[model samples]
Target: MFSCSTMMHIPTSQFLKLSKFKPIPDPRCKTKVATLSMGCFWGPDSLFGSIKGIMRTKVGYTGGSEPDLPTYKSIGDYIESIELYYDPSKITYLDLLQVFWNNHDSTDKSSYRQYISAIHFHDKEQEQQARDSMKKMEETKSNSIQTLLMPYKTFYDAENYHQKYILRKYKIFLESLCLNDDEIKNTYAACVLNGYLGGHISETEKVRILDIGLSDEQLRYLEACL
Candidate 1:
């Protein structure tokens, strides 16, 4: 049995073995990117990590001044944001916007810029789709959505601790992958693990990872997650 903390959906164990694991190939062709700021970055990062089309997810600072290397404490005018690389063939940008709006309280009245909600569009098409979605949402509801539709800007990655907040809790699981901090950021395996931590891993996704050359032990661990 997993501990109370890790019993969210998967069993947990401290045992780790470094076996020969195949690198998850990046199968995306002409991927599109999306950026969003909806309260804390951790949840959004994990949330998107679970989606089918997501190739990579990163939490960072954006939409503010003082781009001089933002630390959590020194994030001058920046708000928390998530940068996502996704395949449009598998999931549409509009599909992501739906998930974004559903995950956040767009009507949030918080005065803190860090907690404010916004979507950074990569191009006019995304901007238009966002606006259309916002309008459609308002058509049936009374509360005004406060999510800002802004143009794309710079994204400064947050500290390592904040990158995969949920999955990082299981140090052994990460150690099994033998990935350095930088490697985890770019790895699709990390993305899948992060998503699994967030209860967003689908059965199809689970099966895919099982074939990624994980050891029997690691495969069992992931199986328990499913």
Candidate 2:
């Protein structure tokens, strides 16, 4: 039996209907990728995923020196990081950089490499932008920003359990969507739902997503969960 602490009943048909719902991509939109490390990756995953322009968000390990694979328990020199895809037409890279700097305590130094705040820039332009942003931040605070600006090497996807960490708490909601682990990690719907469940989604984004073909039952369940 499907049960939750919220004790909301969802019909089987709702699940079936939601299973068919897919996000329609804009043909004209060119997506840009951003990789950021800010403490634990889970919170950043939810935070960035909630934004309207973000197409997908994935938590992973990057900028590590170790050759071995990095798991949560076995991370070598890797840092807990989040990589997200966003439509540049809707949101600029500078906007995401601002969000990254604003949300995390970049000033705090961490002894552990895995928890250090850093930006893994994909290109020269991004590297310059990150450096300029860091300079601005340092100027505003009148202190050196401890956040590292580095060239992005590779992103190793974290274990299945790490994806959509917050939204996974609600079993009924996940069941209704009928998505497997990979789908949950990649789908825009799951990303948005994860954001909403984590209380990161703004009202404007809420209204925008609500009008995106969600059934009445799904809408009610999402609202109730929030």
Candidate 3:
């Protein structure tokens, strides 16, 4: 049965055929990591990439016992989560939490745990802040907060098809990055482009894109895709 929240509606045969490209390295890796589960991972994955200070984002599975079996069809026991790498100096964990609550139905409970809203905190500060944010959110709404706030244990990267889904729709934009399938799934530049292609990009984000080492022709192609 297809869950209303799942985005795996396309037949396997109809999936986009993407080409393999060479790797273009991103030097920046000093950033804080935050993970969240807010229904479908694809939506949140695209959403956070748009925000300033968010360096990179990846869709994965967590909050389950059997981490090995987290395929879309078998992820019933796991929560679909987006792991974010962000610069705390630019964007705080609380700020991301604010976006989390705003972007999805935090008060609504999912029939399956996989799509449930959650904040997978990584540290004591994050834990305290996440709980505080939940309380603050609860005070603002009539409905009870149903989001799961817990310490992050393990995160299993989702399948390749699940990575940069929105950006993948614009195959040309992806090819511009010059990344192979494996590298594309984890590239910081890809994350920014994913958000832009997903419709959450800002002017500042566009400038950032221009500065990320893409050639003039590639930039034109990416702009066209947008």
Candidate 4:
């Protein structure tokens, strides 16, 4: 829960400059990448971004035979996927895989290739883990899972508008952040706020965010946005 006392002191004008409040990882911190497709990338982008350890999230098209670049309007044979950058010390790949399986209907078949469930593993280790996890899921259901396990390949970024779907709806918040196109797509603050707006953030996560040195005015703005 947000602390009411923390919401009463700082000036509102200070909160309007949100870039100052954006979280930045330590320069020496190590991060890992994970990419997967479980249908529309919008939901998963917000879902994964809500997790504490994720550094950034981006939605794109991948796992296709098309030679040209893919966009939402002309996706070709590609799948709608999201790529995640996370702090390994705080979250493991196995943790992300569990979240993936729990949130999407991996066992059901999709007529559209773009919406099919798949995991694009970045390395051999990830591939093995994904396969092992899938095997367990298959055993649990006593039926084969439809999700595909594929090696990492090209990930053509989606158009800017599709990047942070839910968060983009709040124009005032975006204006406050004063972010350009690239910043909006990759910034940590945008990632966290997107999850909050999508209703994926938990009370514990809310407290975690509040403890990140935000001023009183910023806390008020965030709670209001929520």
Candidate 2: worst-modelled 10 consecutive residues by lDDT: 1-10
RMSD of each: 4.2, 5.9, 4.3, 7.3
Instruction: Score each candidate by Cα lDDT.
Output: 0.78, 0.80, 0.76, 0.79
Which clashing pairs does model 1 show? none
What's each prediction's TM-score?
A: 0.88, 0.87, 0.85, 0.85
**Number of the top TM-score candidate:** 1
| Candidate closest to the true structure, highest lDDT | 2
Ranking by lDDT: 2, 4, 1, 3
In model 3, what are the clashing residue pairs, if there are any?
A: none
Clashing pairs in 2: none
CA shift at 118, candidate 3, in angstroms? 0.7
List residue ranges in candidate 2 displaced over 4 A.
1-28
Candidate 2 global CA lDDT score: 0.80
Error of 3 at 133 (Å): 0.5
* TM-score, predicted candidate 2 vs. hidden true structure: 0.87
Cα deviation of 46 in candidate 3 (Å)?
1.3
Can you write out model 3's per-residue Cα lDDT over 22-104, one digit (the tens) per residue?
33466464799998998877877778888888888898899888736778888757888889988877888889988988888
lDDT digits (tens) for residues 106-223 of candidate 2: 8878788888999999999999999999988998785567899999988999998889887787666677667799988987778887788778887766875674556677777777
